[model samples]
Structure formats: structure tokens, C-alpha cells
Target: MTKTTTRPLAELQADFVRVGALLKQAREDVETLRRLSMAEAQAETLAAELEAIKRQMDRAFADEDKAKEDAFIAGIKDVRITEGDQRDNLIRRTFTVAVTRTGNDGLRDWETTAEKTGLTSLKPEEYAWLLRHPDRIPASILALADDPRTAFQTYFSSKKRGYFRGA
Candidate 1:
């Protein structure tokens, strides 16, 4: 024979309500966790996309800068002159002169007109000495300096504008 213990209906009903509330709270917590996980995933994806866009922008800026540099280099004329002494096989000299126009009055004035013949590398005293004794300079180099083409017919013919007006 078994003996059964029974509680009041009100008490049992209150216990059921409490269990139901706990179940609901557990479900809400699970839903919150799911939302948090989804948000973290979305943030990761957005961060990757932002990084990709930044890389593309960086590459674009680099390309633009390279193009500008190439254009500027193209504007300068590089003239190469080689001189060799027949008497001595080892005596050979090469000079590369970079010429460009100057002043705001078109290409009428040219900077480095005489100094562009590789003489700009000399010290002030050495240049003054050369000025006093021009015969020390090679005849071919002097002839090149005397050429009209070396004066006004080189590259960078346009006058500087905007930020480079005085510079």
C-alpha cells in the first residue's frame, strides 16, 4: 500500500507560474545571445570591407602621385655629352646636363643657360676661377654652351604658374 501527499491547488498553480516565467526568461536570453552573435558577424564583415576600400584608395593615390612625378621628369631635358682624349685611352669624361626654362615672361629667359653644362657641380671659388680663365673649359663644351638651342630650345618651355610662380 502507498501513501500520497497532496498540496493545495493554489500553491501548485503558483509553482507552475514561476516555472513558466523561468522558461520565458531562458528563451529571452537565448534570443539575446543570437542577436549578439549576428551583430558581431556583421561588424567583422563591415571591417573587412572598409579595409579593402582603404587599400584601393591608397593605391589610387600612389598611382596619381607617380603620374605627376613622371610628368614633371618629362618636362626636364637631359643632355648627355661625352669627351675622350685620343692620346690617353683611359681619359674619358661624360656630363649630363639637365636644362629647364625659367621666368614668367614665357620661354624668353632660361635658367642654367651656361651653368647647365655640368659646371653647376663646381664650388663657388672654382667657378670664379673658371670665369677668370675660360680657356680651361673644353672647346666642345664651350661650343655646346654657345649653341642657341642650349639656351632657349630645351624642355619646360611654358612659364611657371600658380604655386610655382616665384619658385
Candidate 2:
């Protein structure tokens, strides 16, 4: 049971009403100002302010509409857009090795193996994906008396993500 700050439909309805009120007031002010003995420059300034206010009001309404549309779509199907690292800016490297059932004693050095198996600059998601992928080293590490979870930990290296805590 999570809490919601916005009351979905009602909040949106209220936002629409607020936008309408502000815009309607701006329009009325403009019409009344035009009939007064004001200089052209003065009138223009007032009109410009009204236009600016109207634009902000319109943005409010547009946001309300988009929220409603998103909610309606959410109710139909759980269509979610998930963002992942695609390694767009990464350089990928690959490797192959000969190994025994117990992972050959001289099979590979971590640095050498990484170079031989493959190394690449990777996006966050790609890093995570490779660690958990069946074709990756997760299964192979299990044979070397290495912790199986090491595969997961390796992908989380902060330098690769370009972020370091308390740096």
C-alpha cells in the first residue's frame, strides 16, 4: 500500500480549472485595458504580460492532459518504458579460453582473462546484463571455488559507471 500525493483525476481536474481561471482573467484584463486611454507601448506591455501568463496557464493544462493520457494507458496495460545502458559510448572487447571442469589451473589470469575473454567500456545496464547473462562468467566462476555472487559484484564497479561515492 503506497501513498499517492496526487488524487489522480481530481487533482488534474483542479489544475484544469486553475489554468482556465488564470487565462480567463488575463483575457478580460487585456480587453478592458484596450478600451482605456493608455499609450500604445503601455498597452503592448500589458498584453505581453497577459500573453506570458496565458502561456504558463496553457502549459499547466497541457501537463494535465498528458497525465490523464498516461493514466488511462496505464490502466489498460502495464506499458512501461525502461531505460538501460546500451554502451553507446563504450568500446567492446572479447575473449576465448581453454578450460577444464575445475577451471584449468593455468587457464587465465583475471587481467589476462578479461583481455582474452573480452573487455569493453559499457553502459550501466550493459554491465549489469553481461554479469547475469548465461553466456557470461557467472556459471564459470562457480567451478573455481570463487563466490558465485562475484559475477554480480564485478559489474557494479563504480569507475565503470563514472560515479564514485564521497569523492
* Candidate number with greatest lDDT: 1
- Cα lDDT tens digits for candidate 2, 57-165: 9999999976765543331211111222434321221223222111324766332112113233333333433434435443332333355345334433533665433
Model 2 stretches astray by more than 4 angstroms: 1-38, 76-167
Model 1: residue 153 alpha-carbon error in angstroms: 31
RMSD of candidate 2 to the true fold? Answer: 27.9
- The TM-score leader among the candidates is 1
Give per-residue CA lDDT, model 1, range 19-98, as digits (tens): 99999999999999998989988999999999999999999999997676554444233233334543532112334333
lDDT of each: 0.51, 0.47
User: With candidate 1 superimposed using the best TM-score fit, by how many Å does residue 40's alpha carbon deviate from the native?
Assistant: 6.0
Clashes of each: 0, 5
Clashing pairs in 1: none
